[model samples]
Target: MTQHLHTQADLDRALGELTLRDPRLAPLLALTGMPALRRREPGFAGLASTICGQQLSTHAAAAIWARLSAAVTPLDAERIRRARTDRLGRLGLSAAKIRTLKAIAGEVMKGHLDLDELAGAPADEAHARLIALHGIGPWTADIYLLFCLGHGDAWPAGDLAVQEAIRIAFVLPTRPGTKETIALGDAWRPWRGAAAHLFWAYYKLAKAPGFAAAPALAPVEAGTEPATKPARNPNADRRSRPEAKPAASERLKRAKP
Candidate 1:
């Protein structure tokens, strides 16, 4: 977790390998394409973004963040720490999220977390530190690692979309909770974060059936042709398979967003 940034190829290779093995997850692995590990500098902005994004729709999180950013001159750690709840709320945040944001800001202010240290910390250590805060949890921590820290292996099963995506795509009769999801995601190791990214991309595809459901492909490998596969059977605990569960790689989660 010491933040060994993953290159686009690193992510692509990991995703491609996972896609080929898991028929249910293949399309998603294909759709998201690949992104070079994006490093959002750690500390106030990073923490704030993680909290604000929790459980909110991607569009909703973006809207709120835009407002928050506009409301503050230099929306950095100090500013967020001093800003009043009303100010942040007006910018677009629920009461809970505002509190969560403040808690994170307070930690930053108190020096409980050194932004520099987090940037350098590996995935688990960084996650352990983040969750020490009032509201940070596996889901939130996972998101931060995946997006902010750019920890290649970070994965969050708590994410509803991930759970939902897994449920529908894999045809899982039941949705996996944190423990179960963690257990299930084990095989995606070293690229679990990429898998999460893939799922989001896959969700975009599965939203609509047929053409609308199809995700924009990134050109299949040479000699490959497009074909559909059956959804994953979430009910079938793939846990027993040769693949082990992913280490749940400490990270963050979003409730519904």
Candidate 2:
């Protein structure tokens, strides 16, 4: 059976479990409180939104989706598949994105890619199936699992915000790569989805007023000069090297002479 995170209770449980597994999350929890449960209706609309959101800013995605939704008139798989590319472009979808959207719509219409079936499937299996389709990657699949199907343990380790949050939280010298993020996320298993939410929450809060300087985890970068430079000696450039102090043996020799 597919377990979905529907209530704040689910989020609370996940947060508690995640805290127990990774104490580092405690600081973020204190700073950001419980993360918002970003749930989405599980179906074509959700998948279509994910497709529309690829590489687009939040406002841009919302605008494009709004236009497309209005133009599609009911916005079903068949309509999307039959819609002209130029029409979709006029709705603000790039040609590449239009192709991907149409492909997704066609698959769904043909019953080859059923979002409902995916909703009940294991996260890994569902994720694999999603990525097997054109224009879908690990990040997209993980987003669908977390937000759409509400897979409790879905972790989008490749997400840039999550990586940055991990870097700041862990005090790493640099942002964790996808592999490193995945390894780090493994400790929050069974609640990785919530962990992902927490990271995103922290990412947002850390950028807000008063929290900008909260990331004191890592040391300053290497090769950074001190805040104040030493005063320069104008004659130092022409001055000869200072004489070295004589050793005990040399002093004795000079005394004997």
Candidate 3:
């Protein structure tokens, strides 16, 4: 298999390649610097954490994960499988998430899913296996490949942060859907995962101190093209009121089973 980005040097190489591939990203890269590679070891516990984090904001996910981690103490597949439903439920996990979490843990414990070997598998092969599991969707599978497996080219087209960041950076009149996002991501091959990290960093930096919240660009409707003009809200003044909107996690909740 080709080398995955398992080190800082690997990530640097990917970013450098990205800059050469598309100099348009140079300005955004300069603003954001090298994006941080948020790597996670391949294991049942880390995957379980991803399950728990579904549909929740980063802050909220971290909080719930903290509680679950503390409760389980040594959160392993067996531990999670054996944990009482009431206890897990008390940790603020929704009923659906709890069931999904247990199912994933059970599958791993039963040797039905070997995460280590899976990590080494090709991205398409790995994604096929992951999405076959209950409650795990494309978004979850892509995240697993991108962060857990460190797959160099993994890109989560379904991610709203990525869509929003692209809207802001490209100055698109609207956010691109999965098809559009994938097409746009074609500009950055092999380093698409790094591109994802850069977009997340850009999302934060764009909303950094003194910078206005990036305009809430609407997604272009199906079968129709996006308007050339930026979306306008005549009722509220753009300067005074930062159009009150749902938090990213809230507005962009995962499609949980």
Candidate 4:
């Protein structure tokens, strides 16, 4: 069965289980404490919002999302499909983002992609499906799985913060590359998503001015591809922040079963 970190309790349970699976994480957890559950609206709107945040700062992303949402009525696939490119551009979306959004909307309407169905799918499967889309990259796919769908097994191996955190915690000579990061995450297994949350929190603390450093260990060289792909948006270095809330009219309503 797949695990979902939909609430604080779910995250706590996963973290506990993860600590048991790998005792090294115990100290990291002790340093950082429990992380908060960060969730977004699920379905097409959620995916679109993720796209909007790509390659942009949290404040910039939130501002653009707010303007876009206020301008687009209902803020769904149908609206996106019917919206003009120039209008979307005027709402602060770049041409590339506009194209990506339109492509995703078209897929959703054509039944080629089912955003909601991916929620119950395994993290890897869901990730593969998402990355297969025109402009969605590994980071976007993993983020959607972990944050939007709350898939507990989603491993964001390409995240720079996670890689840096791992280097600091494990006392590596350098930040591990994407492939090395994936290999290291194998130990965490089904709780890798929780580990991701833990590491993100730890990253913040570890970078703090007076935080105690991890004990020195044998240096391991992680020579492989860079932590993130060149195609991915580069603005993910900052800690994840909440996106702007959509207007009441743009909020997603529960779909009928």
| Per-residue lDDT over 148-187 for candidate 4, one digit per residue giving the tens place of the 0 to 100 score | 9998888888899999897777666567777667656656
TM-score of 1: 0.69
**TM-scores for every predicted model:** 0.69, 0.80, 0.78, 0.83
Better of 3 and 4 by lDDT: 4
Return the TM-score for candidate 2, rounded to 2 decimals.
Answer: 0.80
- Clash pairs, candidate 4, are none
Clashes per candidate (backbone, < 3 Å): 29, 0, 0, 0
Off by over 4 Å in 1: 1-7, 17-42, 211-257
Model 2 poorest 10 in a row by lDDT: 235-244
By lDDT, rank the candidates, best first. 4, 2, 3, 1
Q: Which sections of candidate 3 miss by over 4 Å?
A: 209-257
Residue 188, model 4: lDDT of 69
Please report, in order, the local distance difference test score of every candidate based on alpha carbons.
0.63, 0.72, 0.71, 0.77
Better of 1 and 3 by TM-score: 3
Clashing pairs in 3: none
After superposing candidate 2 on the true structure, give the runs of residues whose Cα lies further than 4 Å from its correct spot. 1-3, 212-257
By the TM-score metric, which is better: model 3 or model 4?
4
lDDT of 1 by residue, 1-257 (tens): 23244467766776666667544456555455563455564557776877888878889998988888788867786787788988787888988887887776677788777766765655555666666678877788878877776676676777887886765554444665667676556556545677787777666666756733322222233222223232332333232222332432212121111
User: lDDT per residue, candidate 3, 1-257, as tens digits?
Assistant: 43378887888888787766565565677778887778875687778788878888989999999899898968888998899999899999999988888998899888998988876765556766888899998788888888888887677878999988876765564676765676555556656788898889888887777865322222222122222212232331232222334332222222111
RMSD of each: 9.3, 18.6, 11.9, 13.4
lDDT of 2 by residue, 190-223 (tens): 5778989998998887667776434433223222
Candidate 4, superposed: residue stretches over 4 Å from native: 216-257
Instruction: Identify the candidate with maximal TM-score.
Output: 4
